[model samples]
Target: MNLAELSQLDGPSSELLYNFGLQPVSNRFLSGNCQNSAPTFSLELRINRDSGLIHLGKAFPVDELKPRYSWLTCFEPEDHLDAMVKTIINLPGVDKDSVFGAYSFKDDSTLQRLDYLGYTKQWRIDPEQDLGISDPCANVETYQAVFTPTVAQQICQNHGAADVIIVRHVVEHANNLSGFLESIRALIKPNGYIVWELPDCERALEVGDCTTVWEEHVFYFTTFTFKLLLESAGFSIVHYESVPYPLENSIVAIVQEGKGQNNPNFSDSRIVQEEIDRAYRFVDTIKFRRHAIRNKLENFRENVGRIALFGAGHLSVAFLSTLGLCDLIDFVVDDNPNKKGTRMPVGNLAIKGSEALYSEKVRLCLLGINPRNQSKVIAKHSLFEEQGGQFASIFPGSEVYLEHIS
Candidate 1:
C-alpha cells in the first residue's frame, strides 16, 4: 500500500513499520528486548521531512500459530521509536500497515530547546594560545611568577606558563583580606611585580549606580582605602592607574614586593576619622534609596495583583535585598534553561521559565534582564501579549504597564 493508505491504521500492527531513504542502516540497531535473537518483533524505516539527518522508525511484533502462521499484531513498540521506524519499513513480506503505521517528518523545533541547554559547543583551553602577553621577553629569566590563593594557582597550572600573577577584585570577596594578600605576597618572586585591581565605589556612587555593592564584593576600594589595605598586607603601591570605563569604574595598582609602610598623608587619628566618615556617607545613601523604593512599591501594589521578576542573576539578588522586595515578588523567571527549576541566591526563590508568567495570577512582569538584551525582551513582550498576557517594566525611567488585548 501507498504511504497515504498505510497512514489509516493507527493500531498496534501498524506501529513498527518505518521507511529508509538512500542511507545505510548498519550503524543504527534496535535496542529493545529483541537484542540477540530476531524473535517475533521487527521494525521499519522512512525518511523524515523535518530532519534530513534522522530517519523515522517504527516497530511491531507478530505471533506464529501452530497450524498456520498468522501475523499477530500485539502492540506498538514502545522501546525504540526512532530505530523501529527505520527498520520495519525496509523489510520485505511485512505488510505496510501491519509493520509500519505511518511516517511523518520528525519535529526539529525541539533542537532549538536542546541548544538552550548549552550543548552546542565544546570549549577547550589550548596550551599554545597566547594569554595576551604584551612583553614576553621583558626580564623573562629573572621574572618568576607566583599565584596567591589556591584557585589562582590552579588557573596558572592550567595555562602551563606562569609569567605574571595579578590579584584585583579578589580582595573584596576574601573572608580575611589581610591574610589573603599576605599569602599572595609570599608567592611573588623577589623582584617581581604584583598587580591588583579593585572597584572604585566613589566613582560608582557618583553615577547613582548603587547596584555595584554585592555580597561577593564586600569591600569598596578608593585610592585612600586601597592604599591602607596594601600597607596592612606588607605591600606598598609602586604605580597606580585609574582606567575609566562606561559602566562600573576600576583602579589598577602595581604593588612592590616588600614590607608594609605607613601612609604619610594620614596620621593614626585622621585615618580612623576618614574611614568613619566614608561609612556614614554610604549608610546615608542606602537609606535614601530604600525610602524611594518603598514609596514606588506602594504605588506599584495599587495596580498589579502580583509582580513576577525576570532575571535571576547577581544584580537581581542585590536589587531584591536592597529594596526589601523579596516578599513582594511572586516568583522569578529567567531565559537560561539551566536556571529553571533552580533556587535564586540569597532569597532562595525558585527560578521558573517564561511560562510562569502565563498564569492569571501574575499581573506584572518586572524586568531585570541585562540592558544588552532589552530589545529582545521588548519583542518577547509583544509575543506574550498575543497569548493573552500583560507586559510591564519596572526600571526607574522606562517604567510602563501594558494591558493585553483579549
Candidate 2:
C-alpha cells in the first residue's frame, strides 16, 4: 500500500512504511505441536510526519499475546551496565545513597550492578507482590499495565519517591508510550532523574534489517525520534549516549521531569522529508531482501539436504516469519536449555540444543544471534567448520559463508 492509503489509519501526518504481514508471537516456544493453530497479528511499521516518530500500527493486545518469559537480561545483548551505573551515579544529584526504583525484571542486572557499586536503597516492582498477581505467569501481560500513576503513588506512599529510577530496555515495549512516561513522573521525586536505555533503530532503519521488528516491540526509535518523544512527554534530556553493537545501537539517556522544548529539527521541512525518505528506503530494502533471501535459502535447501538456523531468539523468529523462510529451515538451534525441546511458533520447527548441529548433520546454518556473539559461536563450533560445514549470517552485508545471498 502507498503512503496515502496508510495515512487514513492514524492521520494525514502518519504514513505506513512497511507491513510485515501477519506474524505469530515471537517468544512462544511450546512443547506440543501447535504452530498451525497459533494466532497471528498484523505487524506494520509507520512514521508520524509531524513528529518523525516511527512506531508499529495495530499492535495486538499485550495481555492476549504475551509469551512466557524465558529471556534474562543478564544473558545477552550486552548493555555495559557497569559503565551505565557509573554514569548514573556521576549525575549531579545522584549518589550511592540515592533511592532507586526499577520497573521490571529486565532491570535486574542494572539493579545488581548498582548494588555492587554500593547503592544502598533500591527496590524493584514485583508482579506477584506489588501488583498482587495471584499467578503472574498464568496470564502474562506487559509490565506497563501496572506502570500507572496510581500504582506509582502507592509505591511512593509505602517507601518515598525514588531519587533515581533505572528503567532499562522496557520503554520501547510499552504499548501506551505516553502514559508510561507520564507514570515515571509520579514514581520519582520532583528532582529525581531517570536512567533510560533502549535499542537505537537508526542503523536498523538505514540498513533495513527485517529482524529488527519484533511483535512485542511497539515502537522503533532512532536517536532523533527518541529525544523527540521524551521531550514531547515533558522530560528534559539531561544526557544521551549511543552504545554501538552489531545489529543496532543501545541508547542510554538521563532524563528528568521538567518542561521540555519541542525539538526544532522536526519542524524543518527538509529534516522531516529526510526522515520520511529514510523510512521509504527501509521499506524498499525489506521487500528486496525478503525476496532475495527467500530465493537464496530455497536454492540452498534444494542443493543441501539439511539446513538449520542458529539462535532461537526473537531476531531469528522475525527473520524467519518476515521472509517466509520457516518452511525452508529444518530446525532451530539454541544454546539455552530452556528453549531446547520446544517448538518455534508458526513453523513448529523443533528447537534443539547446539549439539544438534553436529548430530543432525546440518549444513549451512544461518546465524541468528547478535552480531557481537558471532565470533564466539564460530569459535565454539570450530569443529563444525573443520568438517566443511558453513555458517552464514542473516544480517545483510555481513555475510560470512553465504555471502552471495546478502
Which pairs of residues have clashing backbones in candidate 2?
none
Supply the global lDDT for candidate 1: 0.43
Which regions in candidate 1 have their CA more than 4 angstroms from the true location?
1-163, 204-210, 232-236, 245-247, 258-264, 268-278, 345-348, 355-363, 369-406
CA error at residue 61 for candidate 1, angstroms: 61
Q: For residues 56-169, what per-residue lDDT tens digits would candidate 1 score against the true structure? A: 242121111111112211121122223322332222322222211000012122222223443232111121232222332211111112223553344335443222234434
Model 2 weakest lDDT span, ten residues long: 1-10
Best by TM-score: 2
lDDT agreement of model 2 with the native: 0.77
Residue-wise C-alpha lDDT for candidate 2, range 42-90, written one tens digit per residue: 8888888776677788767776666566342234355577788888888
In model 1, what lDDT does residue 309 have? Answer: 80
Residue 93, candidate 1: Cα error in Å is 82
